[model samples]
Target: MTDIVVSTDWLADHLDEVRVVDVRDGWEFDGIGHIPGAVNVPFDTIRAAEHAVERGADPAEGMLPGVETWEEVLGGAGIEPDDTLVAYDDTHGVFAARFLVTALAYGHADVHLLNGDFSAWSRDHEVERGTPEVEPTEYVARESETSPFVDFETVEAALTADDVAVIDTREPDEWAAGHLPGAIQLDWRELVDDDSRGLKPDAELESILADHGVTPGARVLLYCNTARRISHTYVALRHLGYEDLMFYEGSLAEWEARGAPLESA
Candidate 1:
C-alpha cells in the first residue's frame, strides 16, 4: 500500500491504529451501514461560505473552510493532529480525497484514503448502524509549510508558462461548456477503477497521464468545477510521485466570476 492509499485488507488489520472517517452524507451514515468505529464527517463540514466571500469569488462556489473551522470540525470528531486518518466515501473516493486534501492543507502529517468505497467494505466486513461515541481532542492546526493550494492569479500566470501544465479534471459536459485556456482535459474519473471504485493501478495511471503530457518533471496544476473532483486527481498524482503540484482553490468558479479568458473545445 502506498502512503496515500490503504487497501481494505490493510484497513481491516489497522482499524484500531487509525481513525476511519466516512465522508458520506449523514443519512448514508445512518441508513447505509459504515465501517465499524468509523466517524461520519459529512461532506459539507469541511467547506465554508466565507472562503468565497473572503476571496471575492462567487458565493455559490464551494471552498475549503479556514484553519480554525477545520480545527473545530476535526477536533470535535476526536481526530488529533498526530492521528493517522483513513477517509472513505461512496463517490469513488472523490469526497474522501477532499477530506484528505483538507487535512493535508491544515498541516496534518498522516492521512490516507481507503482504496475502495464504503460499499466494498460492507460487502465482506462487519458494519455498524449507529454513530460511535467519540472523545474530542485538542487538534492544533499548524500553518502548512508548503501548501498545495494556489490562487486564481497564480494559475492565470501559469497559463503562459511553458514549464507548467494546467489540467481540468471535470466531466466532458463541463469541459465542453468552457475551461481555462491551454488547460488539458483529463476527467478525474479516468484515473479511477471501474470495478473497484478505487484508483487505477500506478502503471496504468502513469501511462494515461503520460499520454496527456503530464509528466512527473513538469509542475502540474489541477482544477475542477469547485476544486472537489480534482482532489482525487491530486491524490493520484501524489501517489505517482508528482511532487510539484498546485491546486486552484476557487477553480473555474472564480475564473468565470472574475471574467478570466476561457476557451471551449
Candidate 2:
C-alpha cells in the first residue's frame, strides 16, 4: 500500500529488499526478539532536543529536530532516504509511529509501519533474539513541507477554526487532570486492536470519530502528554481516510509548560 502501514506477510517477504527498523530501546531489543536483518533505532534518538532537558523542555516533545541531527542519527543507523523502510515497536506502535513521523518530516517519503507492530509479528513468526550488524551510511535528509507536524502556536491558533477538530489522545485520567479548552479526549488506545495495536475495523473507527464530533472530512488535530501516544491516533485517523490530519508536535508537555490555560474536569 502507498500509505504507511504494512502487513506481517508482506514484511516477511520484503525483509531483504527493504530497511526494517526496530524502534525499541537497546534493553527491549536484547530481551524481546526482533525481526531478522532489522536495525535497532531507539525512539529517543531522534526526539526533539527539548525532551532531554529536565526543565520545561526548552522546546517540546515530538518537535522535529534539525537537519544535522537527523543526518547524524539516521545516517549513523544506516537509514538512507532512498531505502524503503518499515518501522515497528513492541510498545504497541508508539515509538514506531513517532519514528515514521520524524522520518517523513525530514523528507524521507519511503517509510512505512509494520501493520500490527512487532508484538503481533512475534506471535505469528519466528524472530531473531539478537541484534543484527548495522552498516551505517551517510544518509542526508532534505527538508520537506512537514504538513502534519504542527507547533504550539499553530495548534493554539487553530483551536477556534470552524473546520478543525482538536483531539486530545491521552487517557481519561490525564484528560480529567486538565486539557486544552474544547479539545476532545479520545484516548489513542481505543482506536487500535487490543493485541496487535493495529487500526481497528474502519467502520468502527469511523463511528468512534463521529461520536466525538469529528466528522470524516474535518481538519483533524491530535495531541497527548508527549505527542507519542497521539501518533497512534494519527495513524489510525489517516487509515480511516481523514485527509487533513496534523499532530501538535510540542503537545501538552509544551502547552502546560507555557502556563497556557487548561480546562480541568
Candidate that would win on lDDT: 1
TM-score of candidate 1 to 2 decimals: 0.90
Candidate 1 overall Cα lDDT vs. reference? 0.83
Residue 92 miss distance in model 1 (angstroms): 1.0
Q: After superposition, how far is residue 120 of candidate 1 from its true place, in Å?
A: 1.5
Compose the digit string of candidate 1's lDDT tens values, residues 1-265. Answer: 3578889889999899998999898899988889988988998989767457446753323377877888888888888888899999998898899899888778886899998899778777898897778899898998776468876677778888999988988887888789888888898889999788888998899899999988878899888765568888888888888888988766565567778889998
- Ten-residue region with minimum lDDT total, candidate 2: 52-61
Q: What's the residue-level lDDT of 194 in candidate 1?
A: 78
Off by over 4 Å in 1: 50-62, 251-253, 256-260
Error of 2 at 79 (Å): 1.4
Q: How accurate locally is residue 63 in candidate 2, as Cα lDDT from 0 to 100?
A: 57
If scored against the real structure, what TM-score would every candidate get?
A: 0.90, 0.87
Q: C-alpha displacement of 20 in model 1, angstroms?
A: 1.0
For each candidate in the order shown, give its overall lDDT on alpha carbons.
0.83, 0.78
